[model samples]
Target chain A: MPVRVAVDAMGGDHAPGVVVEGALEAVAEAGDRLAVLLVGREAEIRAEVENRGGAEDDRLRVVDAPEVIGMGEAATEALKRKPDSSIHRGIGAVKAGRADAFASAGNTGAVMAAALFGLGRLPGVLRPALPGYLPTPTGTCVLLDVGANVEVRPEHLVQFARMGAVFGEFFLDREDPTVGLVNVGEEPGKGTDTVKEVYEALRALGDRGAIHFVGNVEGRDILRHGADVCVCDGFVGNVVLKLAESVSTILPDLVRAEIGRQGLGADHARTVGGVLRGMLAPFDYQAHGGVPMLGIDGTVVIGHGGSTARAIRQMVLSAARLVEQNLTSRIARALADDDAPPHP
Target chain B: MPVRVAVDAMGGDHAPGVVVEGALEAVAEAGDRLAVLLVGREAEIRAEVENRGGAEDDRLRVVDAPEVIGMGEAATEALKRKPDSSIHRGIGAVKAGRADAFASAGNTGAVMAAALFGLGRLPGVLRPALPGYLPTPTGTCVLLDVGANVEVRPEHLVQFARMGAVFGEFFLDREDPTVGLVNVGEEPGKGTDTVKEVYEALRALGDRGAIHFVGNVEGRDILRHGADVCVCDGFVGNVVLKLAESVSTILPDLVRAEIGRQGLGADHARTVGGVLRGMLAPFDYQAHGGVPMLGIDGTVVIGHGGSTARAIRQMVLSAARLVEQNLTSRIARALADDDAPPHP
Candidate 1:
C-alpha cells in the first residue's frame, strides 16, 4: 500500500496554490507509492487542482476543513478555539486512520499542540522535540529542540539525544549516529550545570550502546559535521539555527556583490547564486516544508507559519516518508527499554 | 600628556619578528604623540628593533624581561612560575606608572590572571570581561565576555552590559550605546529563566537612563548593528565569536570554489578573495590582535595565543588607544552608582 500524507491545504504563506502545486510535483516524483490528502476548503482546493489540468486520481483526495489557525495566534489557544482548523482536521485524519501521517505549514505552536493533544506522546517521552537537519560539508546533521520546548531539563536533553539518534538512523540512514552535547567548549566542565549533567548522562547512555556519544562539541563543530546529533536546550538550539540561517543569507549576498564587481556577467552570477542556494537551501526549513515533532506516538511534522505552497508540498512529502519509514514507532521502541542506570 | 603603551616583545605566534616590526610601525605612525615600551629579552628585542633601520628616539624603549610564557602552558600556573615573564613585566610597568596600559599576544588566561593579581579589578567589578568588537554591515558592535567567565549569573550579565555600554560610549564614541540581551528570540518570555531575569534587569537599568537597553535581540541581530553593546554569558559569547570566524572562513572558500568552476581566471579569483577578505577580515578577532579585559582597574588587553608580530603590534596600538580614552576608569565611574533594582 502507498504511504498516505494528510496536508493542511489552507495553511502556510501561499496556501492552496503552492501547496497544491507542491503536492502535484511530489506525487509525480513519488510515483504510485505516495498518496496526498489535501485537507482544507475542498471547493477551493478542487478548483485549483482542476484548473492545473491534473486529473483527480486514486492517490489524491480532497478533505474539507472549514477553519484555519492563524500564524500569529498562540498554538494552544488556537488549537482549543479552532478545533475544526485545517491543521487540526489534518492531524485528526491521521488519528482516524484516514491518513498515515499529517503535515501542516501553519502555526508551529498550533501544530505541535494539536499533535500532542490529538496523537499524544510516546511512552517515556517527556517532551516532543523539533529536530532540524543542518547540512554540513560531510553530510546532514540533526540539531534537536530547534524551538519546540522553551525550558527543557537535563533529562529532556538526554531524551532528545535518543530520539535524534533514531531520526539520523532512519531518515539519513546512519549507523550508530554520533551524538554530542552542544556547549561552549569540548571540556567536560564546560557549559551550564544543566549541560554538564546532560553530558555525563549522554556518556553513560553511550556506554550502554544507546548512541555514539562524541562528548561536548562547540558551535563551529555543528557546521563541521562533528556529530550526527547535536543536543542542546531549546534556547541554544534556536540561537544556533537562526545564526546559521543569518550567516547563510548574508554570506552569499556579500559573495555575489563581490563577484559582480569583476564583471563576471549574468551567467557566472546565476551559477554562483545557484551553488550558494543549493548549499544553504537545506538550512531553510521552509523548503523542507515542516519540522518533525519527534518522540510523539504518531507522525506529525510542523511547518513554518510563513511557508509557501512549495513548502507545504515538501511538508506533505516529508510526512509521507516518515510514515513509510515508521520513524515514530522506531523512536518509541528505542526509548521503551529501561535497562540503563542513571549516571551520577 | 601623550598615552604610553607597553608591548610584550616575546609574546604571540610570530613574536620578536612580527612584534618588533609592528611596534616599529606603531611608533612611526604615532610619531612623538605616543610612547611604546617594548618589554622582552632586551638584547633580542633591541636587535630586531635596530635591524628595522628606524631613527632612534626616546618614544620607544626596550624593557628587559628574561622569561617568556609559552602559549600551551597553564595560565595561572605559568604566571605563578614565571614572575618575570614579558606579560607580567609589562603589567608591572603599568602598575609602576611607567606605562599607561599593557598589551600582549600571549596566553589570555594568564593575562587575565596577571591583570587581576597585578592591576586588580575596579571598585565593584565582580569579574573582568573580555570585550570583542564584531564588525557588521552598519558598523561595529561590541560583545563582552567572549571567553572570560564560563559560569555566569544574571548579576554578571547586568554588569557585562554596563561595562560594554561604557566601553562603547568611550571607545566607539557612541553617545548612548544601545545594550541588547542576546536571546533566542525578541519575545519577552522567550528565553531561559536566567536570560529572562537578565532581560528584566537590563530593562530596569535602561529605564533609569543609565544605558540605552534595546530589550532582547536574536543571534541574527548580533551581526547587524542591532545594538551598540550586545551582552551575553562567556559561553554563548565564545560560541558566537567562533561561529562567526568559521562562517567567514568557510563561505569565502565555498564561493571561490564555485566561481572557479565558471572558468574565472587567477586575477579574478584574487580579486574576489581580496573583496571578501576586506569584508570578513574585520570579524576575525585574531587579526585584530587582542581583546581588552574591561572592568579592570588598569588596562590589560589579551591577544590570541597564536597571534603573530602583526597581531601583537595591533594589540600595542589598541592598548595605547584604550589608555588615551581612559576605558577602565570611565567604565568604573558609570557602574559606580548603578544600584537599580534587579529585574523580575
Candidate 2:
C-alpha cells in the first residue's frame, strides 16, 4: 500500500492556497510511492487545487474537515471546541488508518493535544516531544523537546535521547547517531541537579550501546553539529530553536546594512546578498518541512506556520517517509529495551 | 580622585602581555580621568609594559601578585588555593579601598567566587548575578545571569530584574530601560511554574514603577532587541549568550563556503568577507569589554578569556566607568527600595 499523508489544508499562515499547492507537488513527485488526503474545508481546498492547474492524478483527494482552529486559540480548549478542525481531523485520518501519517502547521499545542488524544502515546513512552532540525555547517542536528515539556525530568530527557537517535538513524539516514545533553558547561558535573542525573543516565545508556552518548554540549555546539542529537528540557530547547532561526534573517540584514555603508554599489551588493542567501538556504525553516512529534503512536509532523508551498510539500513527503519507516514502533521498541537496568 | 581600575595582568588567555597593553591604552585615552593598577607578577608586567614602549604617565602602576590562577581551576577551590593570585588581589584592592573597581578576563567562576569572598554581596541582594551586554541592531541588550544561578526561584528572578534595570539605566545610559523575561513563549503563563510566578511578580512591579517590565519575550526577540534588558535563570541565559556569540564565527564561515561554491574570485570574496566582518563588529565579545557581575559590593567586570588587547582596554575603561557611576551602590539602592510588598 502507498504511504498516505493527511495534510492540514486549513493550517498555516497561507492555509488552503499554499497547503493545496504543496500537497499537489508532493503527490506529483512521489508517483505511486505516495498519496495525499488534503484535510480541510472541501470547497476552499478544491478551488485551490483547481487554481494550481489542478492535480491530474488520483493519488490526491480531499477529506472534508469543516472546523478551522485559529492560531491564537489555547490548545486543549480549542481541540475540544473544534473537534472537526483541520488539525484534529488530519491526525484523526491517521488514527482511523485512512491515512498513513498526519501533518499540520496549525496551533502546535492543538495538534499535539489532538495527537495525544487520538493516536495516543506509543507504549512505554513517557512524553511526546517536538524535535526541530538545526542546520549545521557539517550536517543537520536534531534538537528535541523543542517546546513539549517545559520542565522535564532526567527520565523524559533520556526518552528524548532514544527517540531522537531513532529519528536521526532512520529519518535523517545516519549511522549510529551521537547524542549530546545541552548544558551550561561541557563538564559532566555541570548544570542543575536534574541535568546531572540525566548525564549519568545518558552516559550509562551510551556504555551499553543503546545510543551513542557524547556527554555535555553547550549552546555553541548546537549549530556546530557537536552531536547528531542534542537533548534538553523543552524550555531551553525551544529558546535555542527560536534563537537559531533568527540568525538566518538577522545576519543577512546585518550584512546588507554594512554593504550599504561601504557604498558597495548595487551590483556588488546583489552578488554578496545572493551568495549569503545561498549559504543560508539550509537555515530556511520553510524549505525543511515539518518537525516530528515523536513518541506518538502514528506519524505526526508539525511544520512552520509561515510555511511556503515548498515547505508544505516537504512536510508531506517527510510525513510519508516517517510512516514508511515505522518510526513510532521503532521508538516504542527502543524505550522498552531501555527499560532494563542501564547499569547491568 | 581618578576612578582606579585594578587590572588582573596575570589573568585571561593572553595574560600579562595583552593586559599590560590594554591598561596602557585605557590610561592613555582616559588621561587623568582613569588610573589602572596592573596586578600580576611584577617582573612579567613591567617587561610587557616596557615592550609596549613603556607608560609615560604615573596613572599606570604595577601591583605585584605572585600567584596566578589557571583558567581550568575550580572557582571556589581556586580562590583558597591561590591567596595571592591576581584575580584575588585585584578584588582585594577594591575590598581594601585601594581601587574603585576590579576587572579580569580570567576564569569566570573564579572571578565570581573571588568577588563574593572578598567584596561580598550588596545589601538586600540574595545572589550576585552576572550581566552581559548583547549587541542589538538598535542598541545593546543586557542579559543576565549569564552563568551565575543555574536554577532560580521567582524571587531571584525579581532581584535580577531590578539589578538588570539598574545596569541598563546606569551603565548602558538608557532612560528607564524595559526588562523582559525570556521564556519559551511570549504569553504570561507560558512557562514553568517558576517563570509564571516571575511574570506575575514582574507585572506587579511594573505597575508600581519599580522597573519597566515589558512582559515575556521569546528567544527570537533577543537579537531583535525586543527589550533593553532580558532576564532568565542563568542556565537558559548562559546558553543564549554562547549561542548568540557563535553566530559571528559560524555565519561568516557559512558565507565564505558559499562564496567558494559560487566560485567568486578572491577579490570579491575578500570584499564580501570584509563587509560581513564590519557588520559583525558589534557582535564581537572582545570589543564590548567585560560583562559585569552585579549585586556585588564593589564594581567587578568579567572579560572573555580570549580577550585581545583591545578587549582588555575596553574592559578597563568599562570598569572605570562603572566605578565613576557608583553602579554598585546604585544596584544596592534599587534592591533596597524594592523591599515593599509587590502587590501592596
Roughly what TM-score does model 2 have, to 2 decimal places? 0.96
A-chain TM-score in candidate 2? 0.96
lDDT of 2 by residue, A1-344 (tens): 78988889998999989988888888889989998899999998888988888853558889998999987789988888888899888887888888888999888899999999899998878899999888999888899989999988788888898889999898568888999999999988999999999899998888888889999999787888889999998999999999888878787778878988898988788888888889888787766789789999988999998899999999999888888878888888888884433222
Q: Write the per-residue lDDT of candidate 2 for residues B17-109, one digit (tens) a residue.
A: 988888888888998899889999999998988888986356888899999999888888888888999988899899999999999999999
In model 2, pairs of residues that clash are none
Candidate 2, residue A267: lDDT? 77
Model 2, residue B210: distance off in Å is 2.1
Residue A235 accuracy (lDDT) in model 1: 70
Point out where model 2 deviates above 4 Å.
A53-58, A338-344, B53-58, B338-344
Query: What is every candidate's alpha-carbon RMSD to the true fold?
Result: 3.3, 2.0
Which has the greatest lDDT?
2
For model 1, the stretches where C-alpha displacement exceeds 4 angstroms are A41-47, A50-58, A207-209, A256-287, A337-344, B40-58, B62-69, B74-84, B260-275, B278-287, B338-344
**How displaced is residue B328 in candidate 1, in Å?**
1.7
Best by DockQ: 2
Q: Among all windows of ten consecutive residues in candidate 1 chain A, which has the lowest summed lDDT?
A: A335-344
